[model samples]
Target: MPEKNSSSQLIEPEDALLEAFWTRAKNVAKINPLEVIVGLDSVSALRPSAYSLGDSSEEADRLCKLVMDGTKRATSSWVASYQAEDAPLPEVGELSIICDGSGTPHVLARTRKVTTVAFQEAGPEIAMAEGEGTFAQWKAEHDAFFRRECEELGIAFDPDGQVLTEYFEVLYSH
Candidate 1:
């Protein structure tokens, strides 16, 4: 039921299991983000962030499938949420472990691009990149989602608000 491959969704990463997963990815992919990205060798104190996609199990399942199948490589997040939680935006070259709803690691990915755009400016380009439906459908869904999230956080949802869009490439999958 877990979903997501973005560093911004980072929950608390479980170190022991994550280290094992990282080992497997390094062996198979023949690349280590720790070294390639942070200039640190393997087995350092640093570890990739871990997180799930949606708020529910079903959403996680659907989104995870999209990511694994390569149909979805981009994701958008509400900047207000990050501000409320005092979390930084996702950055290029960042690595993350995407987990299923059961909290088991499933994929290793690295961010390739990060852009901040106005909600109203996100159109067909963003929608198509997201591999969702048509631009209209994507807009409607995202608008509703933002509204719901804003309500929960006691923040105003603005179509003109900024959104953090992250484009990532999967490095390995289990």
Candidate 2:
């Protein structure tokens, strides 16, 4: 099957594969366009991006579990890294298919709000939504994460770098 390029990975729609998934997701979500929704689109334009987080399979599993439990609602990334990688940044009203460790789509997420702030500006609100403990811990962990990533990529890590944050809501799960 042919593959389509995405942010930092590949998603092979393979004609009906993604279409079928969208149909199933909509059904599981119980979205009745004629009743509960007014501008619901058809499956003709299935544009959800799929992704799996964490470095290890176990880590991915843990993060997915957090997402399923609604403990994780937001995500953060470095704007410079995204730009360098040519990854698509999260946008409002965009749908994302959150895959498990094995890359199987499980939960569907819809972007609600997006904010960009200096690294030092990510506060308690962001920390709580990330489900990664207190603000101080989140900050320290994030700083270390960005610095490590930058070092690995041979790029400079700016302490006041811009952080692109996405706050999403889970729409469906299967």
Candidate 3:
């Protein structure tokens, strides 16, 4: 059976599909460490680095346009142990296919950098990287989002919680 979309669970393509994509990706670059990320879908694909943003199909479509236009270049995530069940921690130069909320792969990108920082340390630079809003806005919005996530996981929200931040360069539109 397919897995549920809980905070602990990361949605991804099936193993067979993932393997097939990997084979194709390898032809484009030697040693491509391919991954799948939840993205927004529309004209192009707006691939967010994390799934906690409550991305809808229409929302994803808008985000997709931003990424394709080279306006949105980065995404972040709060580390989850469950992800290890599917894939390893991201590494620089790894490739990712941005999928919509429905798990349809839409865009391909290459990881450029990954940084770990405390939740409270998400600064203007990070917010700017997301192209979402100001640092204050990012923190306020993310705090609420993470709060609900913590509740679902039966944990406390640490203002100093650590997050995995990733920067990527878009490589393909489809």
Candidate number with greatest lDDT: 1
Give per-residue CA lDDT, model 1, range 1-174, as digits (tens): 123465334333466777899889866866755574565654333567777676655565567778888988988889998897678889888888887554667788889999888998876878887887788988898888788888878888877899888999998987
lDDT string for model 3 (11-90, tens) is 44455554555455444544323332233222122222432123345445555666767777887666542242344677
Error of 3 at 170 (Å): 0.8
What's the CA RMSD for each of the models? 5.2, 5.2, 8.7
- Please report, in order, the local distance difference test score of every candidate based on alpha carbons: 0.76, 0.74, 0.61
Give model 1's clash tally. Answer: 4
What is the TM-score of each predicted model, taking all chains together?
0.81, 0.77, 0.65
Q: What is the lDDT of residue 34 in candidate 3?
A: 36
Point out where model 3 deviates above 4 Å: 1-59, 80-88
lDDT of 2: 0.74
lDDT of 2 at 8: 36
Global fold similarity of model 2 (TM-score): 0.77
Return the clash pairs for model 2, or none: none
Better of 1 and 2 by lDDT: 1
> In candidate 3, residue 56 scores what lDDT?
45
